[model samples]
Target chain A: MIVAIASGKGGTGKTTIATALARIWDGPRVAVDMDVEAPNLHLFLAPSYDGRKRAVLDVPVVLHPEACSGCGACSRLCAFKAIIALGDYPVVFPEMCHGCGGCLEVCRRGVLGAGKRELGEIFWGRAGAADGASPDLRIAGGQLRIGEAMSVPLIRQVRTKANEMLAEHPGDVIIDAPPGTSCPALSAVREVDVLLLVAEPTPFGLHDLGLAVRALASGRVPTGVVVNRAGLGDDCIRAFCHKHDLPILAEIPFRRDIAEACAQGIPLDHMGELRTMMETLARSLRELAEPRVAA
Target chain B: MSLIAVSAQGDTPEASVDPRFGRAKGFGLYDPSAQYWSYLSNDAAQAQAQGAGLAAVELLARAKVTVVLSGSIGPKAAVALRAAGIASVEGADGQTVRQAVAAHLEMPQRGDAKS
Candidate 1:
C-alpha cells in the first residue's frame, strides 16, 4: 500500500510520523521523502547508502548568437515567452524557461539548441537495525537545490523511484509530503492509495488540517487524521472531527520526551509510548490495505 | 521592425477600454492564440494546452498577443515572448488592463519593445 503523510502547514510532524512508521513496520517497507525542497527525512533516518544520484530536470532552450539569421521564427514558436528578440539577437531567460523545446522546433536556422541542467539529487539506501525486530528498509529521498522554484518535477522523479522500489518489493511505502496545497503537494499525493494527515491540536492546526483534508478529498484519496501534540488546545480539533464525522485514528498527547528525541536526532522509539502509538498506527494502516473479509 | 500585437490595455488606455475587443485589455505575444489574454473568462483555459514544447509556441503564434500582465511567468514562456519581439514589463500589479496598457505606451523606448 502507498501511504502518504501530508499536512497543509509545515512543521506539523509529517516526517516524524513517516519515519516512525517506517521504523516499526515489518517487511521490506520503503520510506520515500517527496519533500524535495529542504528534505529533512535524511537527518532523521541517517540511512547508510552506496552513493547519491543527481536528478536532472529538463533544460530550457539556449539561443546561439553565432547561428546567424535573426529570424523571429524561434520567438514566434516559443509558447513560454522564454525567448525575446532584441535588435539582431534573441535573449533567453533560463529561470522563466520550462524547457518545452518549442523554440528548437521552430528555429529554421537552428539557432536554438537543447541542453541539460541539474535540478536536484536523490539519495537511496537502507535504514533500521541490522539485526533488530523490524525488517531492513529501503529508503530514498530527493533534495532540490536551494532557491529552486521548480519542485513538481523533482517530486515526480522521486515518486517514480518509489514506484520502482515498490514494484520490486511490493510492500508498504510511506511518503512524507511538503506542506501547502500547491503543485508539489498535489504531485506527491497523486497515485497514492491512502493519505494520513498529521496535525496538531491548536486552532491554527485545525485550520490547516481542514485545508489538507480538502486537498486530499479533491485528490480522491482515502484520508485519516492523526492529532499530534494533543491535550494542548481546547477540543476544537475533536469538535470539528465529531461535527464533520471525520475519523480520528489516534491522538498523541503532548510529550516533551518525543521532542527531545527529535532534537537529538534519535528515533521516536526512544520514547516508549510514542513508539507504541506509531506501531499501532502502522497496524491499522496494514489492516486498511488488506482486502475486506465478508461477515 | 517586427509586426507586434499588444492588447489595447497592454499598449494604450484607449485600446484596452475599447469595447470592440470584448473589454479584453491584457495582451502578450503568444506563439499561438492559446495564451491570449481575456478578461471575459476567469479561467485561463484559453492558454492551457497539452503537448511537447513546440505546441506551446504554436499556441502563442496563434494567439498573437504581444505582452501580458501576470504575477509570475515561467522562463520558457518569457524567452519565446522576447524572441517574438515581445516586451515584458516586470512588477505590473493592481493596474486595470487599461492602466497597464497606458503605462507601457507612455514609457520611453528602451530598445526592449523591438517586436
Candidate 2:
C-alpha cells in the first residue's frame, strides 16, 4: 500500500513527518520523495544514492524546414505555444511543450520528429538508521532541473520508481508529496491507498487544510491528519478535522529542541520521546492500511 | 501597404497606447493605403491564464498586420512576434496610437523592430 504524506500549506512539517515514519517503519518499506521542485528529504535522510537517471519527455523537433508549408497549423495546434511556424518552418520551444504530440499528428508533411528533453533526474538508494541497529530502508526521489517549469511529470516518475521498489520490498510505500493542492501534490497522491495530511493548528493552516480536504474529497481515499506544532495554534484545525470526520492520528507538540534537532539533520526516530511517538504512529498507519492490504 | 496594429486603450487612433501588449485593452488597426483606422478588441487574449502575449501575437497575425506598435513586449511574446514575422516597436507607452505609428514611420527601416 502507498501512503502519501501531504500538506496544503508548505513548512507545516510534511517532510518531518515523512522522514520520521520512514526512520521507524516496522517492515520493508521505501520512502519516496515527490517534491521535485525543492526536494529536501535527501538532506534529512542522508541516503547515499547508488545511481541516478535522467527524466526526459518526448518533444517534437522540426526535422526538415524545406518540407514545411508554413500553414501555421502546428502553431495553432500547440496550446502551450511550444511550436510556432516561422516564415517557412516551425520553431519549437521544447521547454513549453507538454509532450502531447498533437503537433506531430497535425503535421501532414512529416516535418516533426520525436526528441527528448531532460526534465529532471531520479536517484535511488538505501538510508540506514543512524544507530546502525535496524535494517536499512530503501529510498527514492527526483529533482527537477533548474529553470524547468513542470514538476508533475517528474513526480509521476518518482511514483513509478516507488511502485517498482515495492515489488521487491513488499511493504508500505511512504511518499513525501509536494505541498499545495495543485497538480504536483495531486500527482503524488493519485493512487495512494491512504493520505496522511500533516497540518499545523494555525488559522492559515486550518484554511489551507480545508482547501486540501475539499480538493481531495473526490478521490475518496482514506485520509487522516497529524497536527504538527499542535499547541501553538488554536483548536480550529482539530475542530475542522472533526467536522470533516478525519481521524487525528497523532500530534507533535510545539518544541524548540525538536525543531533544532530536525535542523541539525536528526531524525525524529532517534529521539527518545519522538521515537516512541513514531513507533506508535507506524502501528496506527499499519492498522489503517491493513484493510487495503487484506483486499 | 501593410496594416499596422497599435495596442490602444480605446478603439480610436486618438486613444492612448496600451503599455501591455498581451493584456492590452484593444488594438487600433491602421490601414496605410486607405489612411483608415479600425478597432479589434483583445479581450480573448487578455483573459488567457498564460501565453497571453502569444495569444495577442496570434490576434495580430490573424489580422494580417505586418507591424505592431506597443510598449513593452514580454520575452515569450517577443519571440512569438518575431516568429510570426510581425515587426514591433517598444517604448510607446505614453504616446497616442496615431503618434506612435507616426514615430515608427519616421524611423529608418530595419529588419527587426527597435526594441
Candidate 3:
C-alpha cells in the first residue's frame, strides 16, 4: 500500500516518523521523500544513492518563425500567455510555461516547437543497517532544480518510481510529503492509499490541519493522524480529531534526546516508546495493505 | 510620439503615479504631443484573480497608448505589452502621473524596462 506522511505545518516531524517506520518495517519496502524543494530524508535514512535519473519538462519554444505570419493566434490560445508575438519572433517565457502544449497545436504555420528543461532528478538508493548489513529498503526521492517554480513534476516522478517499486516489492511505500495543503503537497499524496497527517499539538498546526482536511475531502484517500510533540498544546487537536473522526494512530511526545539524535544523523531505532507505536502502526498498515479475497 | 498610460491616484496631472500597476486606483491616459490627459477608473483591479495588468493594458491599447508608465508590471503583462508594441517604463514610483509621463518622454528611449 502507498502511505504518504504529510503535514500542514513544516517541522512537524514527518521525516522523523517516516524514517523510523522505514527502519522498523519487517517486509520489502520503498521509502520516498517527495519534498523536492528542500529534501532532508537523506540525513535520517542514510541511504547510499547509487542511481539517479533527470526529470525533464517539455515546454513550448518558438521555432520556424519564417513560416509564420505574426497573427498572434498561439499567444491568444495560451492560458499562461507565455507565447507572445514580438518584432521578429514571438517571445516565449519558458519559466511561466506549464508545458501544456496548446501553443503547438494552435500554431497555423508550425512555428512552435517542443523544448525541454530539467525540473529535477530522482535519486534511488538503498538503506542498509548501520552495521554494514545487506540493505533491505529501497529509497527513492527527488530534489527540484534551484529557481524552478514548479515542484509538482519532481514530486510526481518520485511517486512514479515508488509505485514501480511497490509492484515488485509487495510492501508498503511510505512517502514523506511536503508540508501545507498546496499543489506540491497534493501532488505527493494524490494516489496514495493511506495518508498520515503528521501534525503537532498547536493551534496553528490544528488550523492548517483543518484546511488540509478540507482540501483532501475532494480526493479519495483514507487518512490518519500522528501527533508529534504532543504536549505543547491543549487538547484542541484531540477534540478536532475526535470531532472529525480521524484516527490517532500514534502520539510521539516531546523528547529532547530523539531530537538530538535526529539532528546528529543518528538512526533512531528501537526507542521504546516510538518502537511500540511504530509496531502498532505497522500491524494496522499490514491489515490495510492486505488484498481482499474474492467474495 | 507614443500615447502613454500612467497608473495614478487621481485624475489630474498633479496626482502621483501609483507604483502598483495592477492594483492602481485609477489611470491617466495622456497624448504626449497634445499634452492632454484623461482618467479611467480601475474598478477591475481589486477583484481580478490575475492578469489585471493585462486588462489595464487592453484598456490602454484600445485608447492607442503606445507606452505604459507604472510602478510595476507582471511577466504576463510585460509579454502583452511587448506583443502590442507598447513600451513599459519603470522608476515611475513616487512620481506624479504626469511627471512619470514627462519623464518617459524626456529620457532616451530604452529597448525594455528595468525589471
- The numbered model that scores best in TM-score is 2
lDDT of 2 by residue, A147-182 (tens): 899998888888788778777667778899999999
Candidate 2 ranges beyond 4 A from true positions: A130-136, A217-219, A290-295, B10-15, B106-115
- Let me know the DockQ for model 1: 0.14
- Model 1, B1-115: lDDT tens per residue? 3222333334433343322121223443322223233432212323434222223333434454455444344455455555554455555445545455546556775643553
- Candidate order by decreasing TM-score: 2, 3, 1
Q: What C-alpha lDDT does candidate 2 achieve relative to the native structure?
A: 0.86
TM-score of each: 0.70, 0.91, 0.85
Query: On DockQ, who's better, 1 or 2?
Result: 2
lDDT by residue for model 1 (A1-295), tens:
7788898888888888887888888887788899988798877877888458887756545456777476777656655545655446666655546667777777777666776667778888877575242776888889997766788877877888877777876777888899988778888888777778888988789898888777764535556778888888878888877876666777878888767778887777557677788888887766654542111
Clash pairs, candidate 2, are none
Candidate 1: CAPRI quality band: incorrect
Instruction: Find the 10 residues in a row with the least total lDDT in model 3 chain A.
Output: A286-295
Per-model lDDT = 0.66, 0.86, 0.77
Cα misplacement distance, residue A234 of candidate 1 (Å): 2.0
